[model samples]
Target: MVESSHHEKDEALAPAEMLALVRDQQRSVEGQIAAFVPLLLVAWGVAWLFGLGALWLIDGMRPGLTVPPAVAITIAAALFVGAIVLSAVLGARSGRGVRRDAATAFPAIVYGCTWSLGTVAIVAVGLGLLANGMDAALARIFFPTVLVLFAGLMFVLGAAIWRAVPMLLLGVWIVAVAVAAPFFGYPAVLLVLAVGGGLGFLALGALSFRHLSRLRRPLAGGRRG
Candidate 1:
């Protein structure tokens, strides 16, 4: 009789143990993301600000005073390359202890590839339209379109994977800014990317870091659950 009772008790505790394991796994994933948040934010913030500033300077404030095409190309290349390098370094460093199962790894790879390809495609399309001498009205829509597509994807992916409210909100904010950019015109679009978007990212990064800090203290005290 005692043996049977002990067997039942062990079975009951098995599920609870499983539940605790899952929660810990999720928390660990979140923590790793938090560690990398600051680096990613800083890299992107610098890229947007620097790239927009370069574009504005090259394009000039008044009409017909634009810098040479070579100068603009060089600036864009440098900013993007630097941002890419910084992000790679941060990812390698912060992801050290994070467990990567197929379930998590596959989604991350897909999201990253999609964004990289989508951004490149958008740039290519814009350049093609400009080269073909597309009308001013159509040309003006290009930047906004790129912003909407990029931000929309981010919002969807973040909502799906992390279910992070702040990330979702940031995506919404970016999309709204992009939609409003055309009304304010080109200079305003630059300001939106550099100042508005950068600030939003920085805020999200800070929030993530704070959340990780809070979780650490509690989890450190004892095994959660």
Candidate 2:
């Protein structure tokens, strides 16, 4: 009886079983990688939606009541800062307990640094242009378009790293919005970012949540089986 039990335990899984196991593992890994994406997207969506929307309202792009631009800008800046802080905390938390070789960790480190450095560069350049007599109206357009374009490029790079099609699509959408916002001119450009870019992020976040739910269901069913 002991020998018979040992033999059974040592037997290889059937081909179908092996394939199913592989697929389950793949889903698990995908879920882990994607787990934080929806939250991040939603957070940014809120920031862009209400934050940029407030800016749009103050810009007097349409004929209606308006708030102080300073007030709108301050609220937007606060929301953006909150999002950035949350992203950093969540990103760091997600990597905990994951095995990290230099090859695997290097890209993430570099990518994080790129965001910091690129943001600084944008600020410096904007300030330099302003000091050199760039018009206030132009400055408003320059800052948002350049910042949004930079974010889009970073998203594309992240998609390449993770092989996530949804992320890739989001990046493409952001790039399109940034490119097109300029044609709408000032204030109106803000509306484009608020409505188009903001709504896009929220929509993608919802879809991603649904996808993640579907991914989890199979894994749960497999475990039960």
Candidate 3:
């Protein structure tokens, strides 16, 4: 009778124990995500390098070699579209569970949407100006507007949401560049957007990757040994 009573007690405790174990695992996953979320920086860096680098090269061509506007715009659009798609995919993969993953991805998705909508609005305004017989000189306003939007997005998402220092710094740098870009001319403006921003992203991406690797190495080593 004692043995049967003990068995009943064990069974009674089993579900509670199982619940505790699951909660622990979920916490562990959340902790990992909190630590490793910056790994997404590496992906973002690569995408920016490719997209902006291509656009810079195309736009930098001398008069004889200038790319047609349609071609340049098409290429830039495709590259940015690819980057957004990849970012979404990467964010989705990093997220572990439905609710948690959605929480993780929601800010980024919103950030992306903000950039997309802002860009469209800016472009529409530019088109309207052009249709109203504005001179081509007004086209220069586009980059400054874009840089402002980029800075705002970084501040809102990186500083406010993720609390990423590098991103906040980048926002400041972009604002400075945007302020000075008009006086410096197109080449300088494009150079800041492409080279300066690309290098900053690359550096942050490298640092984030190193941190993640360090975080993972012990676990990997333990598993291997």
Candidate 4:
């Protein structure tokens, strides 16, 4: 009877040990992820802001398109600050832990907003350049690039939908458009690709931010039942 009792004790210990091991692994991963995600968010935000800045500069240079540089800068800065302010004011997270999710989601929003803004700028420039009788080579560079960009965004957004099947299908569709666009002819092909891709990223960022917003509280801690 003593031997049987000893065997039961050993079995119980193995499970406890296993649980401890798993928890340790989880802690390590979560710490590393927490460190890296916030940095990525800031980088993405800066890049998006720069893209808009470039767009503003390009437009301001053209005659009919010209706007006050100070005005452009002010507007862009406002947008950037607005986003930061929104996070601070609107985030519902009840704990610091859930804030990590918001931080992670912020990059997605930045990336999406970046490309969407890029698309708008390109469209404006394209029109402005057409009106100004600019060189054909410039259009050759801008339009197709914008299309491919849009397509890429669409793919990202689709993935961000947080559904495996839909994201996978969206990935396929995005790839098909990207590959086929070059054949459609310059500018047109690029536009197709950019719009398709850009849409995905835009959608993804929105969904991710939405999800993070909903997660304003962390999971309750305790042993599972």
- Alpha-carbon lDDT, every model: 0.70, 0.88, 0.64, 0.54
Q: Rank the candidates by lDDT, best first.
A: 2, 1, 3, 4
Where does model 4 exceed 4 Å of error?
A: 1-11, 61-225
**Residue pairs with clashing backbones, model 1:** none
Tens-place lDDT digits, model 3, residues 139-166? 7646544655465455646677878776
Residue 195's lDDT within candidate 2 is 85
- Where in model 2 is the C-alpha error above 4 Å? 1-6, 14-26, 61-64
Query: After aligning candidate 2 to the native by TM-score, how far in Å is the CA of 220 from where it should be?
Result: 0.9
Task: Kindly list the per-residue Cα lDDT of model 1 for residues 1-225, writing each as its tens digit.
Answer: 999999999999999989877877777666766767766766666666666556655554566777665886588679878988878787787778777899988987887788778878887888888889977666755654475548655875777797777778878877776666566666556556656666766776677777778877655654644
Per-residue lDDT tens digits for candidate 4, residues 6-53, read: 999999899998987687555544443333333333433443444344
CA lDDT for candidate 1: 0.70
- Cα error, residue 214 of model 2, in Å, equals 1.3
**Candidate whose TM-score is highest:** 2
- Better candidate number, 2 or 3, judged by lDDT: 2
Candidate 4 steric clashes: 30
Model 3 clash tally, residue pairs: 0
Q: Model 2: which residue pairs collide?
A: none
Alpha carbon deviation, residue 110, candidate 4 (Å): 24
Candidate 2 local lDDT, 143-223, one digit each (tens): 998899898899999989978788889889999999999999988999898888899899999999998899899999998
